[model samples]
Target chain A: MITRFLSEVRTSFNPFSPLSKTARTFLAQLPPDARATGMLIKHTILPRTSTQKPLLFVKFKDGKELKLDLETMRSTEVMAEVDRHSRILARKEELSG
Target chain B: MPPRIRLQTRQLKVRIYHHQIPSQPCFYASLATATTPAPPIEQTIHSVSPIARFPPTQPPSHKPPEVRKSQLHREYQSLLKSSPLVLIFQHNNLRAVEWMGIRRELAIALRKVDAELAATGHKDLYADAIKIQIIQTGIFASALRVVEFYNPESTELPTQHPSNPATATLAHGLSRQAHEAASDRKKKLDLAPLLSGPVAVVSFPAVSPQHLKAALSILSPSAPNFPAPKRKANPSYHEPAVQNGIQKLMMLGARVDGKAFDQEGTKWVGGISGGLDGLRGQLVGMLQNVGAGVTNALEGASQSVYFTMEGRKYMMEEAEKGPEEKKGGEEAKPEGEEAKPE
Candidate 1:
C-alpha cells in the first residue's frame, strides 16, 4: 500500500504547477527543520482545473508525504487547529524576542 | 522682639509692623518675588498650573533660627527691587492686624495708587510702594482710596498728596477713563484660553507639600478617577513614610502627566504636553517606515541610475527655460517637438 501511494505521488507531482507559487512561498517561511521534515497535505485547486478542488502535492525534503483528505481539510476542526497553532507560534516568538 | 508676625504664602510674604502709634505704623508685605534667586509663583499667574500634585516631602529644619531669618531677609531683598513694601493699616485699632482683610483693602488701594502714579508722570515706578489706610469712624463707610505713607526711615517723601485738589481730580479722571476703556475692551472680547504655567515656586512656610497635594487634588481634573491614595499604616510591616510619600507623589505625577499610569484613555484627557504613548508609537511607526523605505531604496539602488540621471538633466532643462518658453511651446508645437500631454 505504501509503495502504491509513493508511485501515485511521484506521477501527479509537478514542481512548476501554478498552485505551487503560494505553497512555495509559505514553505520558504517555515523553520529549517520544519521545511526539511514536516509535510502540509492540503487539497487545493490547480491552475488547469480551477473550478474543482484537486489533490495538490507539495514536496518537502522528507520522502514520506502525509495524505490529507480534501473534504476533511475544509472542516472547522482544521481551521481551529491552524488558528491555535498560529497563536502558539506568535506567543513563542514574542517570548523569544 | 517687637511683636513681629510673619505670614508667608507661595508668593506673598506679609511682615506686620504693628507699631504703638496707629498714624505712623507701617504694614509691609512683599507683593511678589518676581526676580531671580527665587522663581516666580506659577499659581499666581496661570489657572492651569503644571505643578506636581504631591510634591516631595521637605527635610526637617536643622539650621539655626537666626540663620533662617537672615536667609529670608536676603531672599526678600532679591524680590524687593520688583515688588516694593506695601503699607496696609487700620485706623483707631493699631493692635488688630487682619491679614486677609488687609490684603483685600490693599488691593483696592493699589488701583488708586496706580492711578495716582500714572497721573504724577511716575509711569517708570515699576515697584513703588503703595500705602493703604482703612478708617472706620462710624456707621458711614466711604469709598476706599490710597494715601502716601510718611515713613521717617526712608528718604523719599510723597511729592503729591492724594487729598490735593489738582492731583485727586487728575487721578480720578485717569481712573474713570481707564475703567471705561477696560469695560469697552471687555465687552468686545469673550474668553481667552489659559496657557500652562511655569514650574511653581516651591516655598517654605504656610504652603506645604500636603497643602499643595490637597489643593491640587481638589482642583486636579484626575482627582475624581484616581482619588488621593489613602495611607494605611500597617504596624506589622515597617512601612517607610518617606517611601510612601515618594510613591504617592509619583502616582500623582503619573496621573497628572496622564499616559504614564494607565494605557486606557479613561483617566486624564491628555496634558498640555500631550499623551506620551501615542507620541512614542508615532515616532516608532515613522522610524520603521523610514527604515523600510531606506532598505527598499538600497536594494533597488542598482536598477535605475541611468533614468535618475536623465530625469535630473530633464529637470534642469525645464528650469532653465522660463514660463514664456513653456507658453510658446504650448501655443505652437514645432515639427521636431514631441506631442506633450496636458
Candidate 2:
C-alpha cells in the first residue's frame, strides 16, 4: 500500500456486515505513525441494521480525491488503486530532483 | 578310555508302553484336565457400570488435543459460555506500549467500580476476571460455533454401554459430536461477521452496567452518557499512549447472553441505569403502577355511579320544594311543617 502520497482518509462501514472486511483491512494497513507523519485519518462505524455500503475516500497530496466502493472491491484492489496515484507522485519527485 | 559321563540304562526313568493308547488327542491332556471357568456370577446377574477407556478429565477429541490451537479453542469455548457479556473490538497496528497503557487505565477504572460496589455490600465483583485479550480469529469463530450450535442432550445415548461407554458419550466442545454440529454450514451465528481480522474481546463474567460504562468511557468515550475521566480526577488516563491506543481500537459489536448487538445496542446496554438491580426495580415499579391503574379504574366506575345517584336525589328534592315554597308564603310556616313531617 502506497500511503506516502496520501494526505487524508475517511471511511464509514457497518462492522457487522461481511462486506466491511476490506474497509477494516484498509485501516489496519496504515502505518502506526500515520497520524504523526501528518496524515489525517477518520472513520465512522455504522450500526448492525444499517443498509449502507462501506465507503472509503482518499485524498492525495496534489489535491486529487478518490472515492471507492468497498462493498464490491477487495483490499488488494484498493491498495493497487491507491498505489497507481502514488507511483505518479514518486516519478514526479524523482524527475524534479 | 571309557567316558565317566555315560548314563546307565537302569537309571533312566522313561517307560514306553506302545500297546496302551490314550483317548485324548494329546498325551498332555490327561495331566491338564481342568477347564476354564465362567465369568464372575455378579456380572452375569446384574448390569455393571461402564468403564471408561480414557481418563475422566481428558476425553478423546476430534482434533489433536496436544496442539496449542486445540487448547485455545477449548479456552475460548469456556470463555464464551461463562461470560454473559462480551464486547468485540477491531485492533489496528497498535504497539505494545499502547496496549499496556490501555490495560492499565482499564484496570484502574474497573477497580474504581469495585470499590463503589464493595461500599454498597455487593459481592459479585469481577474486576480481576475482566480483561481485554487478543484472540486467534479462526479458533475463536469455531469455538463460538460450538458454543452456539452444539447441544449436549442431542448427542447423549439413552443407556450407557456395558464397557468403555465414555468414548461413545463424549460431549466436550472439541469432540466429534460438537465439531459435526458446529460445522454444518446451514446454521449461522449473528456474531460471525465480526470474528475476522485482528479481533479482541472484553469479557465480563457477569453483566454489570456500571463496569461496562467505565470500560466504554475508557475505551471509546461518548459524551454525557459515557464521558472520559476528568484530567483532575485521573491524570494517568490522559497520557498520550493510552489515547493513541484508544484511537486505533474500533468497537464492532457486543454479544450479550448469546444475543448479538451493534454499536448502538452496546451503548444502550451500558446506558442501563444501575445494573441488574436497577432493571429489577424498574420492572417492579411498572408492575406496581399497573396494579394501581387497575384499582383506580375499578373505583372510578363505582364512584361515577354513586355520584349520578346523589345528583338525581338532589334534583328530586328541589322539584318537590318548588311548589311547597310557593304554597307556604311565610318562611316560618315552611320550617314548622318540615319539623312536623307534613
Candidate 3:
C-alpha cells in the first residue's frame, strides 16, 4: 500500500508547478517514513494578486488533493509536526501488538 | 631682766597663735620631700593633663536631593521616549460584513505566526504579541480618511481632531463613503459559488471600530460563524434604496414565487426601509444572501417533490376514470338506444 501510494505521488508530482517555494521545500523535506497512501489534492488559491504565498496541495491515500496555505512557516511547520506525530504513532503501534 | 624675758615670751606665743602655723609634716613625708627636692608640682600637673581643644572640622559635602531627583526624572523621560506605547485603532464606520473578512484574514495570518512560534518553541513571543492592544479608529472625514484602514496597532501618532463639528461630520461621512466603495468591490465578486466552500463573506460598517475588531477576531478559518448584529429600531435609510434596486434588477431576470429568493427579497427590501438604523447596505446584501440560500435550498427540494407528486396524482386519477367511461359506453349499447350513425 505504501509503495502504491509513492508510485501515485511520483506520477502526479510536478516539481516545477506554480506552488509556493515553501510548500515545495516542505514536500522535499518529507522524510522516508513520512509518506502515506492518499489521493492527489489541489490547493485552493485566493483571488488576490498581492498574495505572494504559494498554496499547498496534498494528496491523500484516497486520491484527493487538499488545498492549504503553505506559504507561511507556521502552516508548513504545522504540517511537519503532524507528520512527525503520525510517524511516532506508527512506530509505537509497530512496537506494540 | 625678768621683765624683758617675760615680754619676749609673750610676743612669741602671740605670733605662734596668729600665724595659724601648719601642723608638723609626718616624718616619712618630710623625708620624701627632702629627697625629691621637688620634681616641681607644676611639671607633675602638666604630665597628668590630657590634650584638648582642636577646632571642629567641617562635615563632608553631598549632592542635594533636588539634583538627584531631577537626574532620575531625566532618565525616566528617556526610557519613555525609547519604549513607545502601542495603541490599536478600531474604526467603526466599516460595515460588519467587510470587517469580518478582514478579521478572518488577520486571524489566519496571526495563527500562522503562532503556529510557527509553537513549532520553534517561541511560544513566549507569540503570547506577547497577542497581549498588544489593538486600537481601532472611528470614522474620519477629510484627507486623513485613508489612515482609517491602517493597522491601529502599528500607528505611531494619534489622529488629529477635526477643527469643528462640521468638519468632524464630514470626516465621518467620508468614512461611510469609503465603506460603500469597498462594498461595491465585494459586490462584484460572485460570492454564491464561493459560499459552498470554506470561505465566508464577513462585513462591517466602516464607522465602528469595535465592530471591526470583532470581525477581525473571528475571521479565522477555525473560527465559528460570525454573529449577526442585533436588530435596531430605526431602519437604515440607505439599505432600502439599495435593496429595492437589487430586487428590481433580480426581478428582471426571472420570476420566482413562494421561494426563498422571494422571501429574502421582500425581507431585504423591508429591512432597508424600516429596520436596523445605521446598517450598511453591504450587510443587508449579505444577510439577504444568507437567508435566501437557506430558504432556496429547502423550498427548492419541497417544490421538486410537490411537482412530481402532483403529476403522479393527476395521472392516476385519469387512469381510474378511464374504466368508468368504458363501462358507461357498454351500458348504452346494451340498452339498444338508437345509435345515430353519423
Candidate 4:
C-alpha cells in the first residue's frame, strides 16, 4: 500500500463485526512510524450492537480526501483504492524533485 | 556297493577313554529340561488390561502433536481458560527494542499498581503474572473456539473404537473432539473478527479492573482516565522505541469473563470504580437500597393503618364517654349557668 502520501487516517468500526476486518487490517498495514512522520491515525471502536458500517477516511498530502465504506471490501481492495490516488502523487513528487 | 561299505569301515580309527567311558548325546536339545508352555493369544488378550501407547501428558492431537501450532493451541486454550480478562492488540512490525521497552514500562506500571494495592491491604498481586505476548492468529482463534464451544463432560464423545479404548480417552484442547466441536461455522464467536493480522494478547489471572486500568494506561492510553504516564513521572515511557511501539499497537478489543467486548466496553470494564470487590460493593449497595425502599413502602402502609385505628379508637372512646364528662364539668363550674338552659 502507498501510505507515504497519506497525511491523515480516520477509521471507525465495531471490532466484533466480521465486516470490520478490512478496516482493522488497513490499520495494521500502516508503518510503525506512520505517526512520527506527520501521519495522523485515529481509529474509533463502535459498540458490539452497533449496526453501522465500517468506515475508513484518508487525507492525502495533496489535500485529496477519500472516504471508504469497508463493509464488503477486502484489505487488498482498500489498499488498491488508496494506492490509485497515491501513485499519481508519487509521480508528481518524482517529477518535481 | 559292497566295496564302498568295506572301505568306510577300514578308514575309521577307534579311540579309547582312560576312565569309565560315557557316551554323549549328539543333540543338545535332548539334554535340556522342559519348561511350561506359553499362554494362548486369546486368553492373554482377554485377561490383560489395555496398554497405553502414548505418554500420559502428551495425548494424541487432531493435528500433528509435535508441531508448534498444536502446542500453541493447547497453550492458548489454557490461557483463555485461566484468565477471565484478556486485552488483544494489533502490533505492526514493532522492533525487538520497542517490545522490550514496552514490556519494561508495563512491568513498572503494573508493579506500581501492585504496591498501591498492597498498601491498601489487597492480596493476590498480579504484577508477575500479567504479560503481553504475540500469538499465532489462526491457532489462537481455533483455541478460542475450543475454549468457548468444547464441553467434554456435557457432550457425548463418539465411539473411536470399542475394542481399543486407549486410543481415544483424551478430551483435551488439541483432541479430535475439541476440533469437531469448534469446527462448526454456524456458531460464530464475537471475538473472531478481532483475531487477525499480527495479534497479541495481555491476559490477567483474574478480572481486576484496577490492574486492567493500569495496564491500559501504559499500553493504550486515552486522555481522561487512562492517560499515559507523564514524561517527568516516567521518562522511560517517552523513549522513541516505546512511543513508536505504543503508537503502532492498536487496541482491538477484549474478552472478559467469556464475553467479547469492544474498545469502549473494555474501557468501561477498566473504569469499574474498583475491582471485583468494588463491583460487589456497588451491588450490595443497590440491593440495600432496594431493601430499604421495600421496607419503607411496607412501613408506610402499616403506619397509615395504625394511625387510622388510633383515630377510630379515640372517636369510639369519646362516644362512650358521651355527655357524662360535660355534665360533671358543668356542675363543678356554674350553679346559675345550669338554670340558664330551658
Best by DockQ: 2
Give candidate 3 misplaced runs (Cα > 4 Å): A1-97, B1-281, B329-337
Q: How good is model 1 by TM-score?
A: 0.16
Tell me the tens digit of each residue's lDDT in model 3 across B1-342: 356545655566644355776988677854575444667776664443333222223111122324644333333223222322111121212334444444443444445545654676542322222221111111111111222232234434333233322212122212343334333422331111111111112222122222223322322111232232222621231243322221111110001121112212322332342123335666878899999998999999999899989988988987897788778777777655655442
The digit string of per-residue lDDT tens for model 4 on B1-342 reads: 466545665457686768985877667787786787998887565545456677777777789988888888989999999999999998877889999999999999999999999998999799999999999999899999999999998888764453575656577878888889999999998888888888999999999999999999999999998999999999999999899889888888899999988888899999998788899999999999999999999999999999999999998989877677787677755755756672
DockQ of 1: 0.01
Candidate 1 chain B lDDT trough over 10 residues, lowest sum: B190-199
Model 2, residue pairs in steric clash: none
Ranking of all candidate structures by their lDDT, best first? 2, 4, 3, 1
Q: What lDDT score belongs to each candidate, Candidate 1 first?
A: 0.30, 0.90, 0.34, 0.89
lDDT of 2 by residue, A1-97 (tens): 8789899999999988999999999999998878878899999999888989899999999999999999889999999999999999999989999
Query: Candidate 4: which stretches are off by over 4 Å?
Result: B1-48, B158-162, B319-336, B339-342
lDDT of 1 by residue, B156-197 (tens): 323333233222212221133222333333232100100011
**Per-residue lDDT tens digits of candidate 2, residues B27-66?**
6756786777987987865447666677878888899999
Q: TM-score of the B chain in model 4?
A: 0.78
TM-score for candidate 3, residues paired by index: 0.18
RMSD of each: 36.6, 6.5, 32.8, 8.0
DockQ of 3: 0.01
**Considering every candidate listed, which one attains the maximal lDDT?**
2
- Model 2: residue A38 alpha-carbon error in angstroms: 1.6
TM-score of 2: 0.83
